[model samples]
Target chain A: METIAHKAKLSKSSPVVRKYRALIHHQQDMPVQPDISVKHLNKVYADGFRALKDINLDIEPGEIFALLGPNGAGKTTLISIICGIVNLTDGEVKAAGFDIIRDYRKARESIGLVPQELNTDSFETVWDAVSFSRGLFGKPPAPDHIEKVLKDLSLWDKRNNRIMSLSGGMKRRVMIAKALSHEPRILFLDEPTAGVDVELRRDMWEMVRKLRENGVTIILTTHYIEEAEEMADRIGVIRHGEIILVEDKSRLMSKLGKKELRLHLQSPLEKMPGQLALEPIELSEDGYELIYTFDSQQEQAGVARLLRTLGDLGIEYRDIQTRESSLEEIFVGLVNE
Target chain B: MNLYGVRAIYKFEMARMRRTLMQSVASPVISTSLYFVVFGSAIGSRMGDIDNISYGAYIIPGLVMLSLLMQSISNASFGIYMPKFSGTIYEVLSAPVSYVEVVLGYVGAAATKSVILGVIILITARLFVDYDVLHPFWMFAFLVLTAITFSLFGFIIGIWADGFEKLQIVPLMIVTPLVFLGGTFYSIDMLPEVWQTISLFNPVVYLISGFRWAFYGVSDVHVGISVGMTLMFLTACMIAVWWIFKTGYRLRS
Candidate 1:
């Protein structure tokens, strides 16, 4: 099915498709600059705690890149340094092709940040706050743009209300609006949905998708594995202030995801039979079930052979079930490792 | 030259002042009026003139200078400090603005506020005691120069202070005492010779002496010396503010 779809996509002759293909070809011929790039980045705090260690990363334009990490993994520190909030100890960073240190004004102008903390001007009305953010980037006032951002965030009605009066969820949305106020080409959302409700999370995911469609490069750091699984085009896992893995989401899942098969035994066994002892299988504590673990991508998973061996050994099963490891399980395993 | 960024910060600070109009404007005006009622109207009526100017009018420049210095410091300090305390300063630090633009926005608004307050007080003094600005241009220059210098000093204080109490410490413990001893209500000549010499060491003496000279053409010190002293203080404050931003002292980590 996927092959046929791929073929169709390749064969499509519509004018719009052709134009898009030509545009992509043109872009391929030209050296496309990464939206964000960091080389040998390091951050050491005053007390001698190293927050980030020789980090090197590049985020392509218009991609939804989710950075997943355990707490204290230096995700916020990296983002803060890139945004010019926290000072870097060493190395270079560039945003939207502008050097972060030498061309900071242009670099900062191209990026917007939604911080993890809900720090806002409580006394400021929503409209003023959003507009202020736009102006802070040295952008001219665009009331219509501000209005659109507010409406998009479902904050238009509260435009005149003081931020102190808003609910926590609304304040989070306001943070997003403020980040988008300047119409930046790149956005960094640090735990965007940390405390958000499921519905708001869904809405935010939709909004993010829409933003990507409009060509905004989104780099989001998330503790929620599901959020990354749901929204990331590419996933990067960071641990101990170092990126351990970066790969396409589908590739990562298929490459690392493990499969498990369980067979319920017809009768209890005293122990595993000698012949089946060497197999990648485990007997349940009660001896009423057998669980086999295998890499899904292996050409020979040996499921049939295992079943035949079980039958020849006179072991019968009532039913068999298979389970695929989820991203959360994979994440926990990687972190533990 | 991120004018928009500067304007944004300036407007935001100004809006805060407007939000607390009673405290920012009315409270100081009313307190100064009380001083005028007691010291200017009642006491000055009983006292003889100094430098041939009515005692009531002699304290007018001193009173305006006193308020301008204090208000400039407090306004600029609080303006920058609140953002640091609430974490909104992250936005400013991360914005496209240079340090020059940041200072221009904050100090400019603070000085503007002080100048406006000074003008209002001068008008309020009209109701209590008649006075003249012998050199209106010089009077305006001193008002603006003092406001800007003190505002810059306040900005430095805001960056240095990690706590709210520290914000008030310099303005209260140091500034208030200096202003009181700097001849706010009495000339340094009224003091004994040794005390006068000591009073000359107070920086506020130069500010008040210069401002008083602008008003009645009579000053405790030469006007050139007072202007030079004010400029020197302004330059020192500017250097402190410059160093603060360049080093990211208490701002970035």
Candidate 2:
């Protein structure tokens, strides 16, 4: 590490090397790396309502992380603590190698938050709002850069329009532009699609993906499970203010996920016979199909045993369908568990 | 605190206030004009004079003070209360704008409105009652000082209140009543000795006296004391605002 630092110092005069150095600092090799790390973070309001309880999470660099939870489930509280917008009752958080309390400026400069509400000054033009956000981070004016952000968010055309004139969706897009103004390494979107129409939702998703492509790590909290399923590289589920699980999306699905097996019967049976009744079978509404729901994580779903019992009961099934559980189901199951 | 942040937020706030310019600019003028008409001409026509000055001339300071206080309180409180109602406080809080920038931007804007209203009232008063400032510099100074002081008080009120109903509670229930009881229309000496002593407890008394002294070179209370009290209030309000911002107060935590 010392030699590498020495070598990098020798090449500082080169613009290419200077840019590389700007991205990362020379530190001794540590296997663990997190763009933002929250350690045992806790938040208790003055009224003694504990909003967050010992929540721990380490968001890796360049991953789109989705924090999924019900309302009042500490998702917003966690985000607020990480952004230094809320005080922590206890614990520590580091963003881009800066402790939030000790080095707030650097920690704050490293992150950008697009809030759920359309909170811009209504009288401000889109241009001034975005540019001023940049200045808040102690950044010098970069009009070309600001113009690019506006264009990317499709806001350049309305740059001069007052915020009050824009619709709810447009105001939300302006929020993303403001959050992006500082060019932070980490971006947080708190319910980025809440109350937004379908068209603007798609635009915001694409814009967020583009930001991620530019190497900005994105952390988003959403009540919509589909958003996390579609956009996130990793999923973290918080329940009752505690992080229950955080895992790679695919790996988690394969590990603790479930699949439902459905069987349609040829005959409409008013009631299940004794043999089949002993099995975990749910009858369909029309009395023509028998549904069997079991945890896929179990070593034996007892499909063979159930099949033997169905044969004995003379239950016929010409068609069979299998469905895997969705992230919604997974989330509900985890929260329940 | 930050140049770009302050300018950006300030420009945004100023623009928001300008959108409803008719209400902000016209209401104060009309309200003050009524005072000029009723109190200036009607009362002055009957009473003749006080302190060798016509009743019309005696009320000019009151009219200007009345406009300045109303504009200051409304401008400062609304500047913040709307954002809070709109749920945009989080955006501003999360943004790069420091708390100082946020408070100062609103207070400064409110003060701007107060100053403008004060000027309008002064000009309007001249049309009814003939009065000249004993010292124009002190006149302007007193105008700015009072504006800043009350705007800061309004800033504190904005942060403390949560809703539109709560926002108006302080100004309507407290400040307006004090303005009327602050000897705006008459000298406190005219009151019984017990009531005269009670009037000193009202902070608005100092503000009205200081402002009246600037225009007439006469005051019920000591000019130095009024200015000193305003300074004390200004410093105390600033400290409270700064502390709130630093601790996040009702804003963050």
Candidate 3:
């Protein structure tokens, strides 16, 4: 009921709803529409395996959204459906206000997809591949735009090089250049950094930020929690073919984040105190330290109580510090449940 | 009809062919020349003539048609199958191009390559033996019609095939054997009446006979029947391609 209520409120302000209201009010103002909207989307493959279930997502213009999921969590399936590459079994998708099914050409024209695979035209020069991709979208030749894309990807030096001879990182960049060649309003990157080296990953993240700055809405799916932590404005987690949670990146971290209290003991003990054993506290190996875990959302009153109890039990700590849980931990916990 | 999309895909496929020039153009041309040398010049001379035409000139249309059929199918099937194998087809699928544009791009390029090969084979045959084209315009028409028809057939094969070996199965086992037995080397009239009757059922027989007719004004089947049959086969292949795209068979998941 709560979920329904939340969505109801959201729809009232949603791009579709706003557009409806604008039409009713005869307002000349063109409200900024969602870059992409997926409603109650479900996918069941021919083999009787369900890949996505009741997914609803709305990406605002220019927002960088990150989709995090474990393997087989339908991240690619969701992206594929929106890109018009995979047909949806149920529900509807709209990209830049065009229905993905009914207005497929228009919808696809507004979107770009950089797939996980490093598939390229091995015999063509980098310039031709990107130019041809833009042409495939029915866009007129814009050599300047192609040159800019190649330059932005640091591929200007190798523009004339055959795709087969470029390094793996460069090949991936060429894919990005191709995806961006048509100057799509929405971009979907499926595991863009998967298997990429650290330097290239950093470069790609920087490029994604720049693209967002230029008003391109970017949605990338990755298993790397840190990538989401560093990039996403909003983060969504998917598990077992279901989207379990979606929240502001900071909000999700703070809501489920835990702070660990670690103590270094002056004197070693063989076992944890019985009074503290039931209090979510554990004695470390060699009995030199004790650790306590608690929700960061809660007050620190429990910490003072734990300290007082330690004093009463004649347990002394040399030093203590608290560390908030990282997004990786929170992600693992969410999927594990 | 997204001409730009068609042009892009067509140019891409053509570029790939240029990169593998030896295999795509040279090999087919060289092999056809060998057939002319062995079958037309050497062995054909001993067999004399068929239908008042020298044996070498008699086999010119047959040999050209044989390569055109095989090359058209092989080029198109391989062109599409490679993208599928390399997983690059997703880009094409995700683009704004419709299925018709995709077919036009691929099949058009394949047909163009086959026609070029047919022309080369015809010129190469002249170097070995003298042959006269009775109807020049009709000869060009038959060349293009056959190339386009077989290229569409090859596009279907590409979609149906999943493996590298499967890509070759139809062109090698089915198409080549049909051409060989479809009276490419000898006129079906030379066989027993029963054998000739059986040969009439082969589709390749109509293609070769029609092409042979364009060259010498002599054919086993009527010119009208050959054109009708080619159009019918082309329509069937086009329908199969349409169904493949509509159903997203072997393409979408």
Candidate 4:
């Protein structure tokens, strides 16, 4: 980290870089604010294809905000609009207090986007690609900054290699390096680890965590529920072009997540007992097991009451086990609903 | 102006051109030299001068313009089409650089390559045939303007084309045929009176005729008309490109 600061000092005295450095220093002095804000954003295509409805989202500085959605759920579309890759038909987006359109340069300067597509200048060396991207944002050439980004991405050894010669995982890392080349205050990873291997995915998650620790606000879009569960400080569920839910990761899991209690009976029963029928419980198809579904958020899951009621009803159980729904199930449940 | 952005994109494109030197520069130059060898050397030795200059010398400007038009469009179109094909255009579009800067970078690099190729062909033409640029300043001016104008035209085609075949369609089918019919080999007066009037409608006629005048002070059309038509087409292309960036045509989702 000190190496990065040391290299930053070697950059030409570009006001943009200096201002950006000051902004980093300034970030600590102020209260946390949304590094990115989307207000009533609506995107209706010319042919009347509504890709995104009125959407409002805010990403606080220094937090990982995950936008989770199924395919064609407008996750990429919303990100595109904010990044100015796609025009917003109606609504406003601001990056670091600069409106995306009115102050597009400033907005873009503060944001780095790693697109879902593995698009790169195939003939360009990894070093040139990242360095060029930084210059595109009008930042002065900072070899130190570029070197740090390459090192952080574990791409320092491959800096001189052409992009076409790199593996898929390395290409993705190059894309990340290019995005971070300008030291953007906010980074948008549009599906960072879609087709990567487990090892690479773990490495990416670790890298994302490291970026978050360095005060870079991250907003990643992923269809993988586990990814969001593991990485997001806050998660937003988008479906059919609308934001259905946005909440803290832990809060979302505990609130919408369900827990199931299954009792293995000593003897088969033909039907659910009449007394327990009033409760939210069902007899298994085999008639030897009983299952109860309860909200994990409830103060009391009533497990003790359930056990006592089973005793009064002369039911005997060999064993009982409880399971909390994984984020995948919760996500599927939300989408289906 | 986003000068750094322009330079970044420009340098990247020029670097790509370098990496594929055989395809981008060598291929076109060699092919054009073959045209000079076949037409200027063998055929011209049999034919007489068309307009007070040697048959070989007279066709020099036309040949240069022909290759210039095709190469300018080909280089610019393919340069931009590659990014779109690979989906790397999103990086450029999402960058802080404005549309004007993007165009300046890509088209500027394309035109620069075309100009370099044109100069190379001119030098090659001298080795094969004795030709003097009667108006040296106008020769350079016409060469650069034609390169830039056709490059901008190619930029439009790049944006409009969705596939590789679509990219080649205009350069091969339309532009090449137009250049052939635009008095590239012989003066239009050699054609029947009716065909001469029909040939005037082709935009390549004005470009080739104006360029030929710069080399030998002889043209089928007035030099003023040629420059005017070139400027007019350039303005039209600029407007189309401006509209493309404004509406995000074929560029954005």
- The most accurate candidate by lDDT is 1
lDDT of 2 by residue, A190-266 (tens): 99999988888887788877776677889999988888888887788887788877776776676767767788888
**Candidate 4 lDDT by residue in tens digits, A1-337:** 0101100112213233244345655764554345788888889988998988888887766778888889999999999988889999888889987999999999999999999989988889999999999989888899999999899888999999999999999999999999999899899999999888899899999999888777788899987888988988777888888888777677678888889999999999999888887788989899999998888866275777888899998999999899999888978987887
Compute the lDDT of residue A146 as modeled in candidate 3. Answer: 97
Chain B structural similarity (TM-score) per candidate: 0.98, 0.96, 0.98, 0.98
The residue-level lDDT of candidate 2 at A116 comes to: 70
Worst 10 residues of 3 chain A by lDDT: A1-10
Clashing residue pairs in candidate 3 (N, C-alpha, C atoms within 3 angstroms): none
lDDT of 1 by residue, B20-76 (tens): 999999999999998898989999899999889889998988889889989999999
Candidate number achieving the greatest DockQ relative to the actual structure: 1
Worst 10 residues of 4 chain A by lDDT: A1-10
Best by TM-score: 1
Give lDDT tens digits, candidate 2, residues B20-86.
7788888779878998889888767798566677788877887688778877878887777777777
Count of clashes in candidate 3: 0
Pairs that collide in candidate 4 are: none
Q: Which stretches of candidate 3 lie over 4 Å from their true place?
A: A1-32, A265-278, A304-318
Model 1 residue pairs with clashes = none
**Positional deviation of residue B13's Cα in model 3 after best superposition, in angstroms:** 1.0
Q: Candidates' TM-scores?
A: 0.94, 0.83, 0.93, 0.91
* Candidate 3 TM-score over all chains jointly: 0.93
DockQ of 1: 0.92
Q: List runs of model 4 lying over 4 Å from the truth.
A: A1-33, A263-271, A283-289, A299-301, A311-320
Weakest lDDT window of 10 consecutive positions for candidate 1 chain B: B241-250
DockQ comparisons of all candidates to the true complex: 0.92, 0.35, 0.81, 0.77
Per-residue accuracy of model 1 over A1-337 as CA lDDT, tens digit each = 0111101011122233234334444764665566788888888999999998778787777778888889999999999999999999999999999999999999999999999999999999999999999999999999999999999999999999999999999999999999999999999999999898999999999999889877788999998999999988777778888877776677677777888999999998889899888888899999999999887786265788898898898888999999988888777877787
